[model samples]
Target: MDTLEKEDLARYNRQIILPELGITGQEKLKGAKVLVIGAGGLGCPALQYLVGAGVGFIGIVEDDVVELSNLHRQVLYGIADIGRSKALAASEKLSLLNPLIQIISYQQRLVPENAEMLFSGYDLVLDGSDNFETRFLVNDTCVLLNMPFVFGAVFRFDGQVSVFNYEGGPVYRDVFPEAPSEDQRPNCEDSGVLGMLPGVIGSYMAAEAIKMITGIGTPLSGRLLVIDLLDNSSQVFMIAGANPDLKKDKEKSGTEEAYAINLEQFKRLSDLHAQRVCVIDVREVYEFEELPTLALNIPLYELLTAQLPLDKILVFICQSGSRSRMAVQVLKGHYKGEMYSLGTLLFK
Candidate 1:
């Protein structure tokens, strides 16, 4: 650990004085490398505090450009930053805030192809991405890399924060095994999040990151903190049963390239009577009746144990695209025919 310089002591005097986080903890923060996913609402606030606290190496992964509308909640950018890349803009501002720290900006989306490579370089990850696909990808990548991450999400008046993949604790998959269907899951654009919601949740996320890095306080590893700012009510739910499958190596798991089909493509396939396409709804039994499409109901929990037909093309469907993706993972090597996940599919 590098000794705190005269300038470092002055800059971090307030936090350095805390007995729980004295010189040793401050030094840990100075040596820690944290990668924050997304530079929007949640990422903005997280970046501010993490940098402000003197995290040594911070990386920003975002492909979005600042827009006029993003100014409301994305606190890192200003009027002059509109049309600029979010990753670059955030890195520039964070560099100015903490000149002593190193900031690496990747102005690209966090796709499955690049996730593993990017994650290998960081000690911890902070997920502030708005979409479930990215969230799942981050969770899986972290689990694969044996890295812990702070997860935060804000929807309207409600926000949630959790720590996952920490010391064999429960992960995002243990809580939300599947994502809510497209129509059921609304984005900030459609539903509109309160401007202050992300700030509150992002700050909590930053706190979790610091705790994980410094080993000072108990981190929310197996619990989900749900906060309703509207009523100021908060609840902590203990998540049970971390999925053992997530711990499997990606190459050995055979899920590196699972096939996916959209609703339109599914409809076209159904219309063609040539192929034996079997659509399977992997949601719970109670959710089976609510689906608009005709399909066999095989809950995701029972998928691996159930003897599925191997001759037919299997198409998995769930309320949101999450369960279907899990189903694809379960049936990857066992099934001989082509498989598909109706990920992020919205049925009219």
Candidate 2:
């Protein structure tokens, strides 16, 4: 409450005047601590509005670097940031926008082990993450910690938003009990998304987070909001809590380290005999026109719905390896299958 100085009031004048979010509510916002996972398309707007609105402490957890392709949707970055770390770039931009706020950027990936511990520190966690593995891990960990998190996801022209693990509310595991197997899931890199879609969805997430922090109007707990940008159609549905497994998943990640590969390790693996490992291509049909040696096209969107024979060791493949890395997570969601990704394997 004491943190709201004259500068803060001047900066957030518009929002502070709202009946629901007056000086007192804005004070609550100033006192709140929020963590946003993934600093890409969705994270850009979510973090922007939250920072511009004057949240005192904001934490960004991302393990990605900027590239030429990401500039389309990730508004916080630019051509000058072609090779900089995403979390750093995002924080730097946020700092320029509002120096009164605190921004902590962790330039590392989130895994099952670290996710839970991080969730405990923040008042709310907004998942702007793209992959299913991190999504599931966030849901499970937050559910265990009883944290309030705003969830937003986008694909092509469609997007979905929900609030999970809020006080006295249902968690995401309750809504999505299992990950969409191989054929059912798709990633943004392979599916193609409208740049503004994340802006639309992410802004909603920021609004939800602000409400949760300020105790404003009802949030999206126990309800799902689906938006289609193409037709400007929106639908709201009630999601009942029926999955007992969501409650049964009581495990906690107590400093357990998650495994990840760096550029060198990724290269070393390719030197091995390619035939020994089966490569699963998650790119769509048309993208496969220029096929590579020993590559199978699964096209990310078709995962979870497609049945895999479970015949051999599978190495998921996608452009730049981001989508396939996410695919491995989704596959791990439904089945205990052995899988890995050849991140950007084609370049070398």
Candidate 3:
């Protein structure tokens, strides 16, 4: 083996000493190109360790701005970075951590239109995006592109990680072919997540990415790992691939009844009456105290436990629109009401 260069030797001293990595694996890492989608909590650790370990080319794609709320687990930015672009901030920080590695930043949301072209350029894609919409978008785009991606998600104290589309193995869609409808989904913002959950899951994704690149131990293909911190329990399930393609039933879209109208429309509805339409308010009792509406005051939990009067056209309203969306699912079963979430009724 050739003698290691000074900087190479110093940068990867620990990894170099390992019999598995040696200098050759280190070089493989140096030559690899990785694209991480979404530079939020999950993106932070994935990028940090990848750059620290000498991934030669790293691309970050995120169009979101840093917010005060992100400081809990993003770990890449400080309070000073609030209002800045997330991808740009992550790229600059990763650049400083290891100048030897080149950081590429795509400060834009990955859409169906651009996903195929952009994902084709990288050896591996890492998914740390928060919502089901983005997850479905990224996973489907990966399928069309035939590229492999590491997937991670944190919900409350629970997290899951797995590798998708490897060595002709199963893709994400093979496991979760469909996303939960908007009414069934809950975001971290309202539903809540423990601070360390994202860190653990994101770091696991980085490790898997490194292993996949260097051809190390058996990766998490055809398997799912779920971790629950509060309960201190972990579950692993072996799954079979069915190769289902949702495009066969393409042109899929969410129901109009699940649509959340803006506040103006809600106000206009106040004047215009629908005797059969029931306005459902999901905000907690405390919030309703401030700007009370005539909508039926049903907390999300109450709506779930008790039977719903779904026969009426239901207009779901919340502090924003998140909780109200959850209510629509339960109401859908009881009645085929036209569900509209009044999250658009903001700041008024």
Candidate 4:
């Protein structure tokens, strides 16, 4: 698979003839190892292009099954694929599209436990996952491994595509620090997409992946490309990476990694009320009124000036955990005591 065969030379002659991509670029694609998460709307089209382009090896991770509702956007599957595993079905179709490439299907969910191991072997990752949790997991795992991943997401009539953690560029966390509350997050099942939206976005994702693999053109590393087919408009916005100095200080101090704890952990911490543990709700006053009395109201905007409980274990909470995560980042070097952002359980 390292070198293109005679059949590959003819099959890819169209692309290989391009001045930018000659035999060298085509060979690069043949040697690339890509892993795609999900086989749904975005994944379907992206996988098709990558497979057709003769990417040497591709791995598909999908735990879901094909459904009638998925037919509109998940173009890889057919009516007969309903109830069949998306990973297996997509792999079969993609293999037929290009027998020259190797495709592996993993019929399992991508969780923290398996994400690092699954992503380690691939040179690049294309995220077609729909959920915020999976998206964040993909970002975190990629960041930890120093791997590059192409991110594509579609909602309603809008779509977004970007390459994160590429060559020390801005990562997903630099753009979106935390996931929105479940109430605010809606899927295609809750709010329908334009049927063709994923197709367009997925194609863009594949293009970015190929560009990165073959060193063809610029990849959207620090820029987010937003597409709105409704108005026939597209925009690319430059995103700034998070402060590296603060991260360096934290690591240099040998402090534990900062992260949000789930609902169960938050509950266990609540029992330590008499042990100098303080919960601070960083939401605005109006939103904080609905929260339980156990948490003290200290809006995020006032956190820098307000002071007290320096020796206490500080736990921050907010409506969706976004502001809370920011709060912890704000106080990273200043707070020496134990601190954490409570995951979005209080608002749930």
Candidate 5:
């Protein structure tokens, strides 16, 4: 680590004066490398604080571009940045905020193929993604890499924060064994989130990151912090033991490589191999009734416990891809037939 220069001392003097955070803590903050997963609501505030705190190296991974709707909460970008790549815009603003630190921008979506390689470069990850697929992927990758991450989620007037996969701590899987079905939990677009909710939640996430880096405070490793800005009420809940079955499933899926089929491939397979293939909708009965597809209905929870005939090729479909992926894990070895997850193709 390089010595703190006169400018650094002057810039960080307020924090340096604290008994908990002196020159040593300041140096730790300056040497840390952190990666943020989104450039939207929560990511905006988290990035602001992380840069303001002088984190030495920061990486932003965002595939989206700035839009008019995002201007309300994504405080980092302006009208001039509209239609520009979010990662590039965020990196440019953060660079202007702290010229001494290094900022790297990845203007591509974080996918399973590229996740491990990108996460390997950063010391810690901060996830602010809005969807379950990305969140679960981030969690699984972090668990595989043995890296710690600060997780934050905002829904309407409520938000939750926690630290996962740090020093034998509980991971995101420990807290959320399986993602809720699509209709159960709507996104910000559908449910609507207060503009300031992300700011509050994101600040907490940034504070946790700093705490993890400097070792000054107790991190939210075994506990989850839930706050409701609507009523200004807060509670901290202790996370219980993780699901051993889920852990086993994750490990098995990693080894066997769960097969995925897109819409076109699924269509061709259905047309060509109709005699051998059986499409199973793993969503709830209500969801199946609403969508009314030709596939048979088998709720994912029941599929996990019930035995099914494995005589034909099985393809699982759900609202998004997360449940189908979980369903694939449940039926991997029990069913000898070829298995595939429709993933997000059901929506398409």
Candidate 6:
């Protein structure tokens, strides 16, 4: 194990003064290796705090370039860094913040092919990915590698932080079994977000990492912290361990309704009543490169005014079932037809 030097002692004197995290905890942080998934909103703040804490080794994985839009939240970069690779730019800035630690930059996307190899080298992973596909991919890969990860996500005025797969605790899948496809909903770019929201969530993610590394406070394993800036409130929810029937339990508890059915049920409806069954896809036109033959494209926003066959059994579909459910609700009394929402169980 590597020990902290005299300069390190001075740099982390404030935190080291804590009764729980003294010289020994500082040494643990000095020896820890943490890999962050993105250099966007959440990653920027988390990286800065972790670097300042003297984490010995840190890796940044990002394929995006700095854009003018990212300036509000990604404070690590300046106007001069526009168009620069996020991983490289963040690495350079973090190294300047703490030259004593090592920073590695992987200017590439975290795809399935490279995920396992990259994840195997780190003691822990901190996911700051924006998309659900990447987030779920990270969780699955970490579970396969038997590694724990800190998860953070930010929306317009809301954010969430959690520690998953730690000490045999609940993983991301335990809480969210399914995710919407990329086209299901708009991202921060489309929906807009509060500039400082990621900072709050990312700081929590960094604190969780530090606590896990130093063995100081209790990590958020099996617990999720949700922050809502709009209401100026926060709440922590406990996550149950992996259960194959978690989704079923949710549906049984009335979280999901009878109007929501799986793909198999949708297919059966289409097969049994071919002429009477109609599938309406409530995704944006941009989301589809080529529309599926089975469904008609009707973006959620235009669904209310769209013409539809009143005699047909309507099945609404989207990247995730969220918008589809909304569609069903919107057309319930208006459209005199049997309606169903094919949630995430139905894919492109």
What are the per-model numbers of colliding residue pairs?
A: 2, 18, 3, 0, 0, 0
Misplaced by over 4 Å in model 6 are 242-348
Candidate 5 residue-wise lDDT, 115-231, digit = tens: 998899788999999988899999999999988999999978889899999898888876566776666655689768999999999999999999999999899986678787987
Model 5 — which ten-residue stretch has the worst lDDT?
Answer: 238-247
Model 3 lDDT tens row, 43-94: 9998999999888889999999999999988889999899999988888888
lDDT of each: 0.84, 0.78, 0.77, 0.84, 0.84, 0.84
Question: How high is the lDDT of residue 178 in model 1?
Answer: 74
Candidate 6, residues 1-348, lDDT tens digits: the string is: 688888998999998999998999999999999999999999999999999998999999999999999999999999999999999999989888999999999999999999998898899999999888898999999999998999998868878899998888888876556764556555788888999999999999999999999887889886667787987877655453233365467767866666878878877888899999887787666564444535788966466667888898988876656567667756756787799988652544
- Candidate 5: which pairs clash? none
Q: How many steric clashes does model 4 contain?
A: 0
Clashing pairs in 4: none
TM-score of 5: 0.70
Off by over 4 Å in 3: 1-4, 242-348
lDDT of 4 at 127: 97
Per-residue lDDT over 150-187 for candidate 4, one digit per residue giving the tens place of the 0 to 100 score: 99999788898999999988888776777656655656
Residue pairs clashing in model 3 are 262-344, 263-344, 263-345
In model 5, which regions exceed 4 Å deviation?
242-348
lDDT, model 6, position 221:
85
Q: Could you tell me which residue pairs clash in candidate 6?
A: none
Question: Candidate 1: which stretches are off by over 4 Å?
Answer: 242-348
